[model samples]
Structure formats: C-alpha cells, structure tokens
Target: MSSRRRLGARWRRHRPLRTRLAVAASAAVALVAVGVCTAAFFVIRYELYHQLDLNLTQSATLVIQQHRGEAPGVLAGECRFQSAPACAQVVPADPAKDPGKGYLLPVSPPVRQVAVGARNGYFTNITLPSGEPARMFTQRIGLQDKSLQVALRSDAVRKGVGQAAGLLSGVGAAGVLLAAALGYWVSRTGLAPVARLTATAEHIAATRDPSHRIELPPGPPDKEDEVTRLAASFNTMLGELEQSVTAQRRLVADASHELRTPLTALRTNAELLARADRLTPAQRDRASAALGRQIREVSVLVNDLIDLARDEEPTPLLEEVRLAPLLAHTVDTARTHWPATPFELDLSDASATLPGVPARLARLISNLLDNAAKFSPAGAPVEVVLLAGELTVRDHGPGIAPADLPHVFDRFYRAEQARALPGSGLGLAMARQIARAHGADLTAHQAPGGGALFRLTLPSEGGPG
Candidate 1:
C-alpha cells in the first residue's frame, strides 16, 4: 500500500476519541428508535385491519336481520351485487326461480358445515370472482338448510397500512440522522479544552520556546477537572526547562571567560618555541617549563569544569566511607606536592564511617586541603582538624576579604588579591558541589590565627547535616 493509504488504515483501526463517542451515542439512539418505530408500525397495521373486520362482520349481521321477518328461503337480493354493502353468498338458493335477480356467490365446504349446523361461524380472507381481495363472514340461517356469507373488498385496508409504513420509515430515518449529528456536536463541545491543549503543544514544538503557559478558567478548585491539573503540570514542566536552558547558557559564557588567559599564554609559548634555535640554553629551558605549566593549568581547568557539570546529581551508590583513613592518605599525598607547607592533623575522633560515594568524598577533601595549602605562606602550617564528622582546615596565609566571602563558591569567581595566583577558580565550586551531593555543608571564614579557615560539616550515615 501507499504510505498515505497505510497511515489512513492505521488511523481507522484506532480512531480518535470523539469519533468513537459520537458513534456510540448514535448507536444507542438508533437502537431505541428502531424499537419504537417497529412497535408503532405494527400497532397502526393492527388498528387498520381491525376496522375492516368490524365492517365486514356488521354488514353481514345487518343483512341477516333484515331478512328475518320474511319467508325461510327468501334471501335478500341486493347483497348478491358488488355495489351492495357487501358481496354475499347464500347456499342452496337457485336464482332461476327468481328470474331477473342477480346470482349470489357460492359457499365453500367450510361454509356448508355452517349450513348443516356442524361448525360455528367465523371470519376468513378470500378472493371475489372479479379478482378483488376480500374478507368473508359466514353463518347459518336459523333452523334452515342454508347459509349466509358476506365479504368486503380489502384493497383499501392494505393501502392504508402501506401508507402508515412509509410515514414511519421516513420519521425513523430522520430521527437517526438527527441523533448522529447531535452526538457529534456534543462531543466537539465537550472536547474543546483538549483541542486547545493540542494546539498549544504544537506551537511550542514549532517555536522551540517554553515560555508560554496554558491559561485556565477562573473557578473554585472543587469545580476543577483533570484537564486543569494537566495544564498546571505542563506549566511546571515549562518552568523547569527554561531554568535549565538559562543555566546552560551561563555556564558556557563563564567557561569561555575563564579559559581566555591560559589559551593566550599557550599561544605565546608556541610562538617562542617556533624560534628556539635563536635562544640561549637557560632561556630555552625556562620557556619549555613555562609551556608545560600553562598546559597543566589548562588541563586542570578542563577537568574541574567536567566535575562541576555533574553537579546537578546527588552522590551515586551510597557506600561506607572511612573518613579518617581516606583523609590520612589524601593529606600524605598533599604533603608530597606542597613540601614547603607543613601539614598538622588532629584526627582524635574522626574515624566515623559515612554513607557516600568514596571517590567523590576524597575529591571534596582534596579540594579543601589544596585550597588551604595554595593560600598559605611558604613553610607555614596548614592545620587540619577532624572531630566526629566535622572538619576544619586553618591556614596562616592572607585571609579572604570579607567582601568576597559570599561569592567564594561561585563558579569562575576570583578574589582581587588572589587573581595573581596560579589556579583555576572552580576548586571551591567543585568542593561545594560534592559537599552538597553528600548532604553536607562547606563554608569559609576567618580563623582566630588571622588566616583563611574552611569548615566542612558532614551528615550522619543517612541524614542531612
């Protein structure tokens, strides 16, 4: 089949809601209409035939009564003609003796039984000798060997019933059509809100903007329907989408700004290396070291950006994290890198096991230690203390300015005095992200020793801090 034809067939198999509802309404109305119409037609036919039977029975009785006072065999003559009240038959009566009189219709064997007093009189359908349909009534003349039968033409009765049937059929057809039309109209009226919802969804898809919302009719909540709840849910989803898009745009802009300095330095180092043949031995070595340092800075910034990108999710797969042992190993590694800065640890009651991603917890602790060591003066002590689930890292270096405290954990934020430092600004941001992921909190303030102090408060195994 052609594509369009196949699609049409599929749609027919699963027709729309309105179509099915309309069809159901129409079917119900049709069933009722059919029953009523059939009953009415049969009733009308019965009434028409009943009048014809009464006419035949009455005409026959009146004729028999009129001849009662006469001689026994002297039957009425007018009933023998077609123009009389009814065509009649009188058995055993020869019109030859009563010359110039119209001949009467002959009676059958069943009517002869009435003449012999063998059977009761009854009515029956018959045909006249003139090829006309009729109804006949037969009965015996009292105490005589003769019977009287009367008939009336039935063409008018049949014609009346036919006319009534035609009228009822027309009414039934019109009722069915009207019912189908009304059913469709009612369905359309009820589904108006669904139509509007479909249009709004299509508009959003075409424009790629989630800023628009569905408006609702003003009413009490008790009167509200499922469609109203659906509209509210759709509006909420749009709000979330807009916020996510805004955050993504801001991240991209901030990352570009932070990357500019290192990229420029790398470009300059590349140019210098292109002319390495003209530089002195010491100068070439220094240039090579500078180049490697710039590369390392760029790599660290990229890695930190990746870590912050996963900031929206909580820690995965909660596992027992031995805080004290993880801390000891990380600090030992930090001492190797920052040999000029002495480290002191006071881990008296810090051996508590917490539920978290072990690797993420290690990264959070590392960011804190690295930040403290980088800001401290040469050979100054970076004191690390942990008791229970709280940790404090105090450094004897220039403390953060009060004005910059609130923005310290913001991505790409740098203090005025710290802009000369050789580190990416995402360190504190990544630390805050991981802390939040593990249901903990990290904050920075001035220590009593006139240095920057970073404090981390961790939650219990399954609870928030």
Candidate 2:
C-alpha cells in the first residue's frame, strides 16, 4: 500500500501541470456522463418492456371478449393447431376431461400452476420451447373448468433495447472524447502565464542574471490573479538581488582603493626599520610608531569593510532601550578615546525610549561622537544634545564643504578638507546604515556656530521589540 501511494505521488509530481488539470477535468466529466447515460438507458429499457406487457394484456382481453358466450372446451378447440400473430393455449381444468392436445404455444407446467393458483390474470416472463423469449399472461376463460394462456414474442423488444444501449454507449464515448479535448484546450489557455513564468525563471537561472524581470500582460487592474501575484513577487525578488549584487561590487572596488595608501606607507616604514643601524634612535622610534599606526589603520579599515559587507545578515535583537543612558555611556567612552577634545552633554529630563538593537544603537552613537571629535580643533568643546527622541552632535571645527555635505554618509567618502584624517571613511556610512536598520534617519549640516552638526532622529512611538 505504501509503495503504491509513493508511486502515485511520484507520478503526480513528475506530471506536467496542464496534463494533470486536463486529466482531472476529463475524469469528472466522464463520470457524470456515464452516470446520466446509464440511468437513461435503464429507463428506456423499462419503458419498452412495460409497453410490450400492456399490449400482450390487451390482446388477451380482446380474445376473451370475442368468445364470451362459448363453452369452456370450445375455446381450447378453437386454438388447437392454429398459427396466430400471438400464440394462445387453453387447458381444461378437469383433468379427466382434458383433451391434452397441443396448440400454437404449448402450456407448460409453470403456466398451468400460475393459472391454477391465480384468482385473476397474472403475467410472467418465459422462454418458449423454440428457445425464444416471450411474455405470458394466464387466467380462467368462460367457466371455472377451463383456463387460457396467451404469450407474445419479446425478440423485437430485446433487439430494440440492445440497439438503444449500443447507441447510448457510443454517445457516452464520444462525449468523453469531446470533454477531454475541451479540457486540454482550457488547461493550456489557463496555464499560459505559468508557462511564461517557468521560461523566464529558467532563462535567468541559466544566464546567472538577477537583473532579468517578468513583465505582466495588460489586464483589468481589479482582476488580480495568482499568476499575476507570483510574477510580481518574482520581479520584486530580482530587484532586491540586483541591488545586493551592485552593493557587493561597489564594496570590493572601494576596499581595494582604500587599502593601497596604508599598505604603501607600511612598506615604507618597514624598510626604514630594516636599516636600524643607519638611523638615529629618534628616527627608529618614529618609524616603529608610524608602522604601528598604519597597521591599526589597516585593521580598522578591514573591520569596517566586513561590517559593511554583511548587509544581508538577519536583523539584530531589538528591545526598548532608553536613549539617555546609552548616549551617556557612548559619550564617556568617546571621552576616554579622545581626551584632548572635550564633549559637553546637554540631555533632556524627559526619558526617551525606542525599540532598537542595543549594540547597534551604541555603535551609531559612538560613530557620531567620534566623527565630531575628530574634526574639532584641539581644546574645543563638542556639544551633544538629546531631546524628544532626537540626538544632535555639534563640533567646533571647520564645517563640511557645501558640495560634500550630500555624500557625507556615503561609504568610503572623504571630503577634501578631511582627507588627511586618520580614520576609515566607513564610520558615517555605517552609522547611517545602522540608523536605517533601526527605522531612524541621520543627516549632516553646518552648525549655527561655524561647525558641522549631525542630527539623528528616532520615531516618537516605539516599533516592534
């Protein structure tokens, strides 16, 4: 049983959708046709037999009425050896007086038994001595001493029923064939969209092109079908895939370009250190420090590249986090990292909360603070403000150039003024990515007091935790 079920399942799966649909429709139509045809054939056969039985009964009645005044034995004598359209027979009720002569249809024991037992006329089916089918009616004739039997041949009825049944069978077969052909046409028409979808998917797969998309046929806007929905979903998925591929390519190209300068500086520094005896102690110390700084720079750049590359990672765990405490912590950490640049905090008393991943939010705050501190002049204060779910960081330094303001958040984008800064340009880019992931926005502009201001805004209402 299990093996048979498995085989059926395999057959269904391997079968084409159009073929399956056609077969299913055809089978349903055939079943209904067979049932209706079979019922009609049986009804026709019953009606034919009923009509034949009525005619035989009427003939028997007519013969009795015609000989109403005759003696019981005289009626038997009249039918003796007579060949009529319908066969007739008579038997004497009195056994001793019975002539025992044969007539057109000889009375059998079964017919006599029926006549003896019956109070009135009764009909039955029988086969005559000649091996032909007939219907017989038996009853008493003029008196109690005699009985009569009348029979009609049923060969014609049988032939008519047989022909009708054959005709019904032929019609049923024709109907089934027509139903199958119609089902095939309907299935092909209905599944045309699916066929097109399959072809497009195969082409994309073979060519390894994520840019390929399915175009929907023009139809009524209100008539949204499964095929249309599926095509739309496929196109959306392809668009996302294309964007991801483009981002990946851009990351590789940018990383390669960014690594060249530090790598070259490291090589130069290493050569100078290799000639230790030819250099002064101060020069050797400087060379070693420069090499170490270059290594740290390269390490930071590599780490930033990895962080940016993981664009498809699952979203980090989010929880309702209080902005005040997290921002304070980030500022304290930034102060430890950049002791020369003082950070002044101006936080609101109102507690601001939002749904966010704690670590990512912290990283975003740290990057904004670090960016401000890096551009600020020595001994200048970097102001940090948190109010009404919005955080603003301002640095007292030369503001960003107007042309560079738009692309400050772009990956690996360093403006002409800040190109000499010792940091990978991925900080602002990663900050913006994290902000977007947490359903917030980050923007940069010139501050009121001739410095750059970066503002981070969070939704006033919390999102899913």
Candidate 3:
C-alpha cells in the first residue's frame, strides 16, 4: 500500500473518539433514511399496482359495452375507438369469425385463455407477441349478450413501478448526503473548545513560556468538568515553575557575591609578595610578615568556602554533653589568646540535659567565647552563664546593631563592627547550623551592659550534663 493509504488505515484503527462519533452519527442517519425510503418505495408501488388493475377493469367494461351497441356488419373487423375513461383492450364480438386474430385479448395465450373468476380480479402469467415476460388481468364484462373478455398488458404497469422505485432511490441518496454534511458541521462546532485547547497546548510546548495562559469562555464555572479542571491544573503548574526559576536566579546571584571578596584579597596579597626583594631589611621583614598573614587569611577563606560548598547535613546523634567542663576548656583556650581579657564562668545549674552531637556542641560554645574575647577590651570581663538548659556569652565591647541581629546567622553575613575582626562571618552561621541539627535554638541579642549577647537554648532532657 502507498504511505498515505497506510497512514489513513492506522488512523482508523486508532479510532479517536471525535472521528468515531462523527462516523457513527452519520451512519445512523443514513441507515434510518434509507430504511424508511425503501419501505415507502415498496408501499407506493403496491398501491400503484392496485389502482392500475382497477383502471384496466373499468376500461375493459366500457369497451365491452361499445361492442354490444356498435353496428356489427360495419364494425366487423379491427375495432378501435377511444371513449370515456379511455378503453384500449378490445376483443371481437365473435372470436370464431376472426380465427387468425388469435384470442383477441391484450393478455398473451395461457392467462388470456383462462376466464376471470367470479370475484372479477385475477393476475395471470403471460407472453406478448414481443416475447416479453408480462402479467395480465382478464375480467368478464357486461350482462347476457354483452358478455366479453377484457385484458391489459402487464409490462406497462411494471415499467411504471420500476420508474417510481428509481426516483425514490435517488431521493434517498440525496437525503443521506444532506444528513452527512449536517452531522459533520454540528460535530465540529460542538468540539470547537477542544480544538482551541489543543492549539494552546501546542503553543505552550513550542514557546516553553510558563507565564502564558489560556482564557476560558464565559460560562458557569464547574470544578467537576474534566476540561475545566485540566485548565486549572495547568495554571497551578505554571505558578510553581515561576517560583522555582526565581529562586534559582537568586541563589546564583548570592553565590557570585560571596565568592568575589576572597578572590580579590588573594590577588592583592600575591601581588605585594612579588615585589618584596627591592625593600630594605626592616621594610622587607614587615612585607614578609604581612604576606604570611594574608596567606594564612586566604587559606582560611578557601577552607571556609569549601565547607560552604560541601555543606552536607549530618544525621542527628543524640548524646549528653557536660556544659561546665566544655565551657572551662573553651575559656582556657581563649585565655592563651587573650590572657588580659577577664573570663568569668557561672555554671551552677549547667548539668541540664539535652540531645546533641558532643563535638559540634563544644564547637558552638568555643565560637561564642572566641568572638567575645576578640571583641572585648583588655581589662573587660567576658561573662559566661549556664543556667537550666541555656548558655549565654556577653562581651563588654560595642554590641551588634539591632537591625543586623536578624541576619547574624546568615552565611557570609557580618555587621559593621565585626567586619574588621579576624574571623570569617561563617562562624556564627556554622554555630547556628550545629545548634539546629540537635533540636536546639540559637539567637543573638543585646546584653544589658552594652555588649552583644549570644544565647543558646537546648531541650532540658538529653541536654548538657
């Protein structure tokens, strides 16, 4: 088969609902029309034949009457006349007188030879002189001396019946054509909404634009309708797509901003070290020390960047932590760095229980103490409190601005006072992350005595011992 033919056959086999609906509707109308027309054709033909028989009988009766009244000697042979109701069939007044004329009846031999019954109606099988198959009607007419046979050629009646049937068939075919056209148009109009939806979907696929939308025509809004629900679902999908795209763009922008600072610092320090040989001994020593410091800072920044990039969440591992001992250890380490800065610890009720990772909890406490020691003046005391399940660290240095408190735990974020400090901004952010992993909360606030207060709260049970 040709490609087009094969494709058409495949489509028919698939039989999509719209095409099937149209075909079925059209076929039903055609079948009903044809059936009704066929029945009507048969009924009309039967009635025509009945009326034709009555006409033949009436005409034959008139011809018999004329034969009885006519001048016998003058109209002896080949009698032919047209009168009321038109009489065509004629038989001689005496059949024996014209023996060569055969039976003198319109019907051929066999049926014409048999006399019509008392009922005055009989159909006969016959053959005309033309040798055509025909049916005849022969009826006796008049009374006593007027008695005669009348016959009619059945071929003529059959010809008329055939003509009627042909006409009905043509009319039926025309009706089917009209019905098919009507059905196609009605189906197309009814399915217009579906066509529009298909076109809109194609456009969406081509453009890949989630912002575009379809407008529904005015009607009663029903949630139960499948097409309406599909439109609603598509709109919801577009909303989620927009949110996801926006979030991705924001993340990219934030990552770019955070990477720029470390890169600039690394470049500046490397360029300064390259020019070290031309300087005097004292100047060269200062430059070498500055280069080492910058190198260490760059290394720290790079490590922190890697940590941020590889931030895999750890699974929760609940364990008891001893806060007082952990704080004392952290303070002892802080003293080596800032011995002049007074460290005061109050851990009377520090045995409160909490669920936490021990190493991370210790790191959280150490970061707070380190921040306090670095920011406070030499003689200023850094007060540490462990009460119930709460730990507080306060520094006498300038406190963080109230406006910046909310953003303290955000990655790579720092207040104005903390920007010149030695630590990266990620310290507080990391502390918060560790605290949250163990079902605890961490917050930054202002201490009453003009310093920053960092508060860490854990559950009473499974908290620090």
TM-score of each: 0.59, 0.75, 0.47
Superposed model 2: Cα runs more than 4 Å off: 1-22, 32-36, 50-99, 102-156, 220-222, 312-321, 336-342, 354-358, 374-383, 394-410, 414-422, 436-465
**CA shift at 404, candidate 3, in angstroms?**
2.0
The lDDT of model 3 is 0.66
Top-scoring candidate (TM-score): 2
Rank by lDDT, highest first: 2, 1, 3
Clash counts for all predictions: 0, 0, 6
Q: Give candidate 3 misplaced runs (Cα > 4 Å).
A: 1-262, 309-312, 316-319, 460-465
Candidate 1 TM-score versus the reference: 0.59
lDDT, candidates in the order shown: 0.79, 0.80, 0.66
Sort order, TM-score high to low: 2, 1, 3
Better of 1 and 2 by TM-score: 2
Backbone clash pairs for candidate 1 read: none
Q: Write the per-residue lDDT of candidate 3 for residues 53-137, one digit (tens) a residue.
A: 6655666566656665432122222322222333234333344443453443353333223332234446554554555544444
Instruction: Please state the error at residue 188 of candidate 3 in Å.
Output: 16
Candidate 1 Cα outliers beyond 4 Å, as residue runs: 1-9, 13-197, 218-224, 310-319, 335-344, 373-385, 392-408, 415-418, 436-459, 463-465
Best by lDDT: 2
Model 1 lDDT, full chain set: 0.79
